[model samples]
Target: MDSQLHIFFFPYMAHSHMMPAIEMAKLFASRGCKASIVSTPANAPHIHKAIESGTNLGLEIGVLSIRFPTQEVGLPEGCENANSLTSLEMMNKFFTAVNMLDQPLEQLLMEHRPSCLVADLFFPWATDVSAKFGIPRLVFHGFSFFALCALASLLRHEPHKQVSSDSEPFVIPNLPDEIKITRNQLPDYMKEETEFSGFLKKLDESELNSYGIIVNSYYELEPAYADHYRNVLGMKAWHVGPTFLCNEEKEGYKAVRGQEASISEQECSNWLDSKKSNSVIYVCFGSLANFVDSQLMEIAMGLEASGKQFIWVVKKGKHEEGVKEEWLPEGFEKRMEGKGLIVRGWAPQLLILQHQAVGAFVTHCGWNSTLESVCAGVPMVTWPVSAEQFYNEKLVTQVLGIGVGVGAKKWARLTGDSVNREAIEKAVNLIMEGKEAEEMRSRSKALGVMASRAVQEGGSSYEDLTALIEDLRLQRHCCGSK
Candidate 1:
C-alpha cells in the first residue's frame, strides 16, 4: 500500500450522511489521494453533484454504485427516495440492508484495489471488507463525539438491560466527561427491547471495536470524549472535524438542479435577502423530522405570535393538507406578508444560515445541523424533535452554552404537543431580542472562529487529519513485515 493512494468512501444513504462523507472525500482528494464515493444508485442524483464538484475542481474523485435489494423488507418501493421517514427508522432499515450490500462492496474493493476503505458507522462489514483486501479500515461516525460516545456506552449494556426506565442519568462509563443522559434520551431502539434494539446493538459492538473510529468533531469542543476514545477505550480514533471547513474552496458552491425536481431551490435566497440584518428567525428541522397535527399547529401559532420576521422552511407533506395557514391565527400571513417567508421544500440551508439577515436558528438540533449552525456563527433555539437530538440539545444548551433548548430535560416538551401561541412568542422573543440571545450570539461567533482555526494548516483538526494519514502509511509499512 502506498501513502499517496486511492481510497473508497461509503456514506449512509441520507443527505445528512452523504454530506459529511462528501466533505471528507473532498478533503482527502485535495490532499493528493483519489477517492471513489461508494453509494447506492438512489443516492446518485444528490451525490453526483458533490462528485462532479470535486472532480471538476481537479480532485480525483469518482462515484461507485452499490446494489439495493429489489424488494425492501420493511419499506415501500420508493421509501429510500422519500425524505419523510424518521432518522431512527431510516437507520433501522439501512442497517438491515447492510447484509445485502456486502457482495457489491466486496466486488468494488477487488476491482479498485484501493489503499483503504473509509465507511459510515452503520456498515459493520466495512472492517471485514478492508481486512479481506489487506487494507486499513476507518469507520467514520458522521456525528458529534457525544453521540459516538453515547453509542459506545449503549454497546456495553445488555440489550435487555438497556431499556430500563429508571429516572436517573445513565452515566457513560470510562468517559472523561461526565456526560450523563437519561434513558428517555437514548437512541429510540434502546428505549425498548424491540427487534431494532437487538439488531442495532449487534452492529454497534462489531463496528465500535474496529481498528479505528473517525468522528466528525474537533478535539477542543469534545476533548473529553476524544481523549476517552484514545486513552480509556484504547482505540485508534481521530477527531478531524468541524467538517465543513475541510474545503474553503468549495464554500461558494451551490447544488445544481439536474433531473429530480422533487426538491425545489428557487427564490429562497431572495427571501433571506429581503429580511432585516440579524433579524430573521430561520426554522428548519432537517429533512427527516415530521410533526403530528397538534405539534404542527402549536409551532405555527408560536411563530405567528412571535411577531419577528421569520423564514420557516417547512418540509413537504409534514402536516395534513389545508393546515398551512389554517393552523396559525387568521390573517397571520397577511399581517406578516413582507416579514415572513415560508419555503415549504428544500432551501439552501448553509447559504441561508450564512446570510447576514439570518440571526437565530429554530432548529431540531441534529448533529450536522447543530454543527452547521455553530460554524455559520448563528445562535440557536434548540427545538429537538427526536432521536439523538435530545443529547445534541444537552450539548448545545448545557455543555456549549451557545444555544437555548425547548425542553427542560431530555425529550421533555417545553409545551405539550400543542403549544399555545404565547409560549412560542416568548421562546422566539428570548432568542431573538433578549440579552441572553446576544451573549449566545457572541459566544457562538467566537466558537465559529475557533472551529475555523481547527481545520486550518496548523490547527487541531488539520493536524488530526494529517496524523490519520501518517498512521495509515505506517500501518501499511508494518504489514509488509508480517
Candidate 2:
C-alpha cells in the first residue's frame, strides 16, 4: 500500500451530506492516505476546519474550492447550501448551480488524477466524469442500508400507487422486515410525477453503473438489509459508517453550518448537570426542516404538557418573526422558564445527547441525527418530515424497537392539519414515562455500545474501512504498473 494514494470526496451542498463526507475524508487521512474534499467557496470554511483538525494529527487532507454559480442560478450571494433556500422553485436553481460545476470538476479530476473519486448520489453525471479518467467512482448515499432497501423496494413494487387514498396503509413487499407505510407518508416525488422523480430515476441508473456504493452505516445496525443489498441488488458495496464516531478524540470536529452547538460546552454541561440521569428530552429537526406557526405552537404546547425537562432547537425562518408573541400560548415561556431551554440557532447536539441528563430525542428522522441518537443511546420520538425519512422512521421504531412515532401520517405543510398537541403529548409521554419506554431505553443502550465498538480497532466498520483503503491502494499499484 502506497502512502501517495489520494482519494477525492465530493459531497452535496447540504449539511447532512457534507458532514459525513468530511468525516470519511478524515478517516482516510488518518490511515495515511492523501485525502481531499471538493466544495463551493461558501462551503469551504466548514471543510477547512475538519482538514485543520486532521493536519494537527499529522494527516494531509486538502480542500478544493470550486466557484458556486450563484448569480447564474438567480440565487443571492452566500446562498450556497439547501438551508439557505426559501422555496421549492429555488431548489431547482440550486441544482442548476450544482450541475454547472461539472466542467470545473472534470478539469480538477484530470489535473489530479486521483486513485478514486467518492461522490454524492445526487450527481448522476459523476460516473461519466470518473470514467473519462479511468478512476473508480464510489457513490456515497449518506444513508443507512435499511432506508436504501425500503426505497428500492418501494420503487420496484410501486405499492403506494396501488392504494386508493393517501391515508391508506400498505405493506411493502419483498423486504426483510414487515413494514407498513401510508401513501401520504411517501416522498412527494413518489406521490406524483415531478421533476425530482426524473432526477431520482437518473440517479438510480447511475448508481448501478458506478464503481460501487459506500454507505454511512454499520453491519451490526442492519445486517439483514446490508446482506439484502449485496445478494439481491447485486451491487458492490461497503458498510463503514457512523463515520462521525470514528474521530471522537479529535478536537474541533464539529458539524458544518447549523449543526454546531450554539451554547458553550461549559454552559451546556452546567445546565445538564442540574437534571437527573435520563430525565431530559432533546428536540430538533435537521437544518433544512422548517415548520409552520401552527405546527410550532402544537410542539410547544405538547412539550409543556408533558411536564418534563427538555431542550428544543428552534431555527430561524422567514415566517418565524413574532413567533413568541403570536404562535405560543400566553405566558408560555414564563411558565416553562425553569423546566425547559429553547436554543434558537444551533444546539451542541452531540455533546447534549451524550450528557447523562438527556433521555430521549424528538427528531425528524434524518440519517445523520438518527445515527447520532443511536450512538448516544437515547430513545427517540420519531416525526419524519420528507425524503425517505418515513422509511427511516420504520427502521427506528419497527425494526430496531428503539423508538415510537408521533402519528404523523403525512408530510405536513402550512396548509395541512397540524400533528396536534394530543399526539405530540402522547408520543412524549410514551418515550418518557410509559412501561415501553424502559424496553426502548435498554435496547437503545445496547445498540449504542455496539455502535461504539464497531468503529474501534478490529471492529466491523473498522475492517470495512481498512478493506476499502487497501482495495484502492491495490488498484493504484495495478494501474501504475501498466
Candidate 3:
C-alpha cells in the first residue's frame, strides 16, 4: 500500500499500434498507475507529443527508448518504423532489425522492471523477455474480438482447405456466427506456410505463453465474439477500448489523434458544412496501403460516377521501378472541383467521419479505421487490402451488417484489385441511400452510442480497465520484484 504500480507499454512501430497503446497507457496513468511507453528512438518522439497533456496534468507517465540495430541489419538510418519502407522487398531486413531489438529491450526491462508489459503482437519474443524478470506481459492485439475469434476458428478448423479454389467461400466451423471466408482473403500467414507464416506461428505461441490479452474493443461491440474468445477459445482476456474515447474532446484533438493533418480541420469542416447531413462520403485507406494507377483510376472514376459529394484521402506513392502510372484521368480534378475534396496525404480521418455531413466511408477496413467508423455512426463500403482487413470486412458485411463489400477478391498491401469503377460505384450507391442504407445507418448510430457509453464511468470498458489494472497489481504483489 506504500507504493505505486508502474506499467510499461511497448507498441509495434506502426501508427495503429502505437496510437492505441499510448491511449491505453494514458488510461492506466489517469487511473493512478504509473505508466511508461517503450519505443525505439524513431518511434519514441511520437509518444512524446501525444502524452504531453497527460504529463502536464502530472500523471505518472513518460517514454522509454530501446536501441534499434540499423547498420547491422542492413536497413537505412532512422528506418525502424514499418511506414518507412518504400517497397515490400525491404521487409526482410526491416523485420531483422526489429528482431535484433530483443537484446536491447531485455536490457531495458532489467533496468526498469515494471509491473506489467503491455506489448504489441509484433514482438513474439516479448513473452520470454518479460518472463526473464518475473513481469507479467499483456498482449495488446489491437483488433476486434470478432476478427480474432474468426481467425481462431479458421486456425482450429482448416475449412479453407475444404474448398477447391482460393476464391471459394467456406464456413469457418464453431464460430459464434456462420462466418464464410475465402483462402485468398486470409493473411499470408493463414494462407500457406512460408517464412512470415512461421513468424506468425511464433507470435501465436508467444501470445499463448503470455499472461493475457488486452484488446482495443468493448463487449457491446461484439458480445458474441467476446464470449466465444473467452468461453470457447479459452484465452485469458480483457476488453478496454474504444480507448480513444479516453481523451477529452478539445479543439483539433480528433484531427491529430493518429497523425498530423495535411489539411486544416477548419478547412475540411467548412467543406462539410456546405453539404447537408448524410450526403458526403469519405474514403481513405490506412497509412500502409497503396495501389497502382489502374486501381486508383477506378476509385476516382467510381466517386465521379456516384455523383455524390465526397472527400478522398490519398498519399503520393514513391514511384517504384521508375514508372509512375497516372493515378488520375485527365481533368478529373476539374470535374470534381466542388463535388469532391482530394486530401493527398494524412487527412483528419476521425474528424471527417464524425462530421454531420459525412454519411458513409470507403475504407480498407483497418481495425482503427473500422472502429473509428463505428464510433462515428458511419456505414462503409469495405475494400480490405491486406493484413487482417479481409477478415474484418467479413465482420462488417456479414455479422455486423453495418457495411457492404466492394467485391475486393485479393489480399496485398500495394494492390491492383480487379474491383473496377462499376463495383465501386454500386457499393457506394447501395450504402449511401435507400431503405437499406437508412437501416444500416440506424444500426451504426445505435452501436456508436453503445461505444460512447462503454467508456463512461461504470460502463463495461471502464470496469474492465479498472479490473485489469487491479489484476496486474495483484499479480505483481504475488510475482514481481521491487
Which candidate leads in lDDT? Answer: 3
lDDT, candidate 1, equals 0.72
Residue 478, candidate 1: Cα error in Å is 2.4
Q: Tens digit of lDDT per residue, candidate 3, span 79-159? A: 988877878667788888878878888998999888889988988898999999898899998888987888777766778
Give the deviation of candidate 3 from the true structure as CA RMSD. 2.3
- Runs in model 2 deviating more than 4 A are 1-3, 53-56, 252-260, 317-324, 412-417
lDDT of 1 at 74: 73
Q: Provide backbone clash counts, one per model.
A: 0, 2, 0
TM-score of 1: 0.88
Residue 346 shift from truth in candidate 3, angstroms: 0.4
Model 3: residues with Cα > 4 Å off, grouped in runs:
53-56, 317-325, 480-482
Error of 2 at 152 (Å): 1.2
Task: Sort the candidates on TM-score, descending order.
Answer: 3, 2, 1
Model 1 C-alpha lDDT per residue in residues 1-482, reported as the tens digit of each score: 34577778887777777787887888888778888898877777678776665244678888888767636657555555435355556655755665678789989899888877888777777788778879788887676777766566666753325535645666666555566667655554666578867667656765655668877888877677777667776667887787766654463454331123233445667776766789998888877775554665677778877778888876655445755544455676688788887766666677777788989998888888898888888988887766568767777887788887665344532221234556667778888886888998988888888889999999998898888877766776787668
Query: Residue 476 of candidate 2: its Cα lDDT?
Result: 74
lDDT of 3: 0.86
Which 10 consecutive positions of candidate 3 have the poorest summed lDDT? 316-325
RMSD of 1: 3.7
What's model 3's lDDT at 81? 83
* Residue 15, candidate 1: C-alpha displacement in angstroms: 1.0
